[model samples]
Target chain A: MLGGGFAEAVTPLNLLLCLTGVILGTVVGVLPGLGTAMAIALLVPVTFQLDPTGAFIMFAGVYFGGQFGGATTAILLNTPGQSSSMATAFEGFLMAKNRRAPQALATAVLGSFLASIVAVTLVVFFSPLMVNLAVGFGPPEYFALTVLAFLATSAVVTGDMLRGLSSLGIGLAVAMVGIDEQSGAVRFTLGSTQLLDGISVVVVTVGLLAIGEVLHVASRSRRAPATETVASGRPWLSRRDLSRSWRPWLRGTALGIPFGVIPAGGAEIPTFLSYGTEKSLSRRRGGGDEFDRGAIEGVAGPEAANNATTATSLVPLLGLGLPTSATAAIMLGAFQQYGMRPGPLLFTQESDLVWALLASLFIGSAMLLVLNLPFAPIWAKLLRIPRNYLYAGIVVFATLGVYTTRSAVFDVLLLYVIGALGFLLRRYGFPIAPVLIGVILGPLAETSLRRAMAMSQGDVGVLVDSPFAVALYSVLVLAVVVSLVLRARNRRRAA
Target chain B: MSASVHRTTPAGESPALGDGARSFWTGRSELFVGVLVIALGGFLLIRSAMMDVPSSVSFLGPRFFPVVVGTLLAVLGVALSVRTLLPRSAATADEAGGGDGSAVSSAESDSAEAGARSDWKPLLLTGATLAAHLALLQTAGWVIAGALLFWGVSCALGSGHKLRDLGISFVVSAAVQLAFSAGLGLPLPSGVLVGVF
Candidate 1:
């Protein structure tokens, strides 16, 4: 099956699609205020005409390329393309500032490549087992899983728990719009015929990440400080840099793969975890480690972790029909558009498509490495473009992307409204990830809860009946408790 | 542009004055966010109540989840508001430090100062441009409306090169129009220049 999948993915047309997708993804990822989610959302309309396998192969390429490409901007410009790259920006940007732009870029690329390869390998091997486990999950278990997702994302993603919860609440409220699925009752449409189908996630994602980011940038009084671009030397790691990076790379991969398997939104948590781990390890080493000042381990570990988590996030999306991030949610929408459902049955029902997608992941990872490594310097030069024209181009693209989705002017209006909300969220320090997660998962959670309730005939005990539910609930409790404890400890230390 | 406006105030005088001003604003901002959340919750509750569900539906009707979510939101909003009103707690102080156990209040003050300095004109202009583009889309076509939007955003962002910006916007909009409509078959409105392209 693996061999056959590879053969399918390696076709001339499919390979061409993969290259186009990756190149597009790189361009978007390198630009500040544009992200993988926005890129994927924009690509969906274009991919509508393609076959499922070919389209998905391109998406995989885009996904890998976007994740890897973000590092270039983060390193050179001190501006992350997305929040997941925030950790990369922390140390990688410092490295570039210290005149090691080439080294930082190379470290990021190699780390991403290595972790992606490991993650894809894990997916190829462990997906069957995951599918079997997922097949056993009923409504109660699935509801438990979503609860876990909500708790994990809201609790872990943001620094302020209250703000995160508020963001989550706002997202759930947004999700509640349009007609109710069960009773055919129109909930929050406010007598608009166009909104009966609900606010499209494409519009929401593009609005928040793209349009909102542009607004936020525009509102800033001070432009970003001029970046010091040095002549990038040959992209290679020293013997010392290699030896130092390898362990962190492996550790980051280990830390990141599990996050992907679960619906933990994006790679934000794992990348942070990797960075924190590398920082502590370097600190303990205590001899010229330079952990605070552009440590290579700091860049390598988090970059690897981010790409690894991105690759593995597909496991849940593919095998369990759960979308952990905004991009995944959009991909899930794409799946539905084709009248194909993703889950345990997907493997059997659409075996060829699944294989081709899996095969494309490997090919895309390799393609990303080939494209990014040699061109890291050129990609960094994207920052030299005039800010006005760059941002103006983004606005035009964003408008076109949103308008093309449903050709409804109402969506364009909604886009600005959501963009305003996004700006406020950022200004007030509200984490945007939970909102996207909630919008994606809220309906599924409601459906699952209702199904569970109907099954038990309002007994309510059915929610905790299964062992899986019990285990999931226990984990949720543990996660909340641990986060609370950590918060208290940090507070005490601060005091 | 306005390089003279970038001159820094005397460091000591500004920090002391800024801190006094910032704390008050931060506290009020938190309260405002809380009130907004509570209001949204109330709206959701009212809207959910107005939802006409069929009597045939069982215990888990459409209103149950919305009501629950609204109630939770309202409660959380109150908590957030109360927390903001109370004297500064150590936990929140730590949170203001960026949660890394570093510089207690400086990080908070820096970001607050940055926020204070934000210029809203560009944001407003961008919003206006989007609105105008959407309004003109049907009457003016993709090329004209999109180019106008592009030019408007460029001007808003402080681009001085009008002719250059206009040329770029025209080329970009036309290129996108061609790619999406001609290449991909996505129907874009072709208003005034309907037959020309």
Candidate 2:
């Protein structure tokens, strides 16, 4: 069913590129304040200078490479290298503190790498089926889907649904800032020429996540000291760890792919849902005691789900121009940079690049596994870096990165402002993920909504007229009610 | 030896901030954030009203999207603020009690102090150096700013010594520059000295 030459096309050079990307990605991933976005931003300009295939190969490698690498910091250190790794931190850190760092790290890497490969394979083989599914989508359906996405936003992004939902609203408002496409009138731009094109998602992402993280670290510098050593545990998976992990790994993959396809706030939801599911299903490990205390399944399922969802997230991004997560949003930028438009057409138009990229996925996983699994102890050493200095460096890198993107002093200033805002949002319990989801998806959602409305002569009824749209709306309504009911029920039960 | 600040917290909860402070930090701040969001929404709504939003048939127009988003933001912001203000009863509290399952005894507190012995100078020093890097990169060039950034952050994050950290930062930045600017061909900003060899 597959071509031999294509499989073997992963030559030494391809391997070298994959290895280099994974290594660089891992280093960046292990570090705080930097993530796939920063990594991609720094690396994107370089993709232009190399062979398209080789460059794409490396980009694909680094893309997943960053995902795999982010988990290292999430588990070993409390800081997540990427936002997607946040759910991993919820349970992974507990395992680390319980002297089970080895198993936790192992399961995380293996789960991530394995799930990515599976998802990549699915993309390669079943992409056409996915496109067919996406083709059936209509404007009303999209609107309903977005509502469902919003419903899950609070649950996936933050501990409190209200905060997450509020954040989502703020995001939609930010998305509204540019021109009114249908009316051709300026809405929120207050007469700045730069506001004509709207704020670049690149600028917002780099500023909010990268710059925000830097400022956050700086605030803590005065109050906290930095440490140089992490948990000195054997990084290799023990047999007991292996025995506890395999089932959850499978369960995680199943949970991840469905949620990923549904467009409900990215992998975070699946990871959290997986965590909650595993926490419940877990047999009382210590004879009547709950598994929350150093429970291996806590680490295993969520980590697996995190990877699975991240991998499967590509389905929507490629099949439809929809991005459910921030990383996917950035990846959409990457596709645009290459002058490739995503949607149903991408599968046919960019078939070679798609396959080659898929090939690189398998290669990237192998490299990450080799790097992370065997050399996890070496990565653990990175936590030994002093926090103040680490954060201070983040400030420097974030500034330099923003400056390089546009070479404007204003951008640097923007970075600092964003950094401070990020610190405040984080210091409070406001989740930063929605802000990103907003910045990235906001424009598209608004444009689609307005476009759909205009087509129907401003009839709100048309949005629900389509059966597919009606079904989607029903799902959204169901999600909101179910989650609310579940929360109230949980509260009652606990009471 | 300087004490480490980040790792000293036994779990997500910071001992430095007590329960009242923690609740206020999380709760009151949510309310404040809600107000700020509502205000931003109002500003957007006002701006949309001023714009010449062209109308359509018997349904909504361009203003509809912004209006809907703003209204939702305002309503949700109010809900969030109100929720934060209300104190939860004992029953709901237990459900939210998921923290890292570490019992930090008084004896463990002493060990935590022992584990925290790392300096804060590197972090502060790096921040200042980075500020200098940004201020001077245009005049001094990429080599200086880039290297300073690398060296500064490494030092601030607590590398063992200046000599070793300086060497690593220099080599790393230089290699990055060569790969990015020379090999791949995306020209980095050289600041003030443009085209002057």
How well does each candidate reproduce the native contacts, as fnat? 0.42, 0.28
Of the candidates shown, which would achieve the greatest TM-score relative to the real structure? 1
Instruction: Summarize candidate 2's per-residue lDDT along A1-495 as a digit string, tens digits.
Output: 225325633778877887888887777777654666567655654455556667667766776767766677777776666656766776777777777777788888888776777777776666667788767776666666556555555453344565566667766776676676556767788787666666655566666666555544543434443232255666667787788788888888888877666656556567777877777777544422446566777777877787777677777777777666656666776676566767777767776766676677777887788788868757756766665456545555556556665666656655555555554555444555566666656656666676677678777787788777777677767766776677678667866
Chain A only TM-scores, each candidate in turn: 0.93, 0.82
Once fitted onto the true fold, the runs of candidate 1 whose alpha carbons sit more than 4 angstroms away are A89-100, A238-241, A263-265, A279-286, A289-295, B1-27, B84-117
Q: What is the DockQ of each candidate?
A: 0.32, 0.20
| Model 2 chain B worst lDDT run, 10 consecutive residues | B99-108
- Docking category of candidate 2: incorrect
lDDT of 1 by residue, B92-158 (tens): 5634533121110101112333333346688789888988998999899999999999999899888
The Cα error of candidate 2 at residue A294, in Å, is 6.6
Ten-residue stretch with the least lDDT total in model 1 chain A: A222-231
| Model 2 spans > 4 angstroms off | A1-14, A32-56, A70-113, A154-157, A179-183, A221-245, A264-302, A337-339, A493-495, B1-32, B52-62, B77-197
Range of the 10 consecutive residues with the lowest summed lDDT in candidate 1 chain B: B101-110
Total clashing residue pairs per candidate?
0, 17
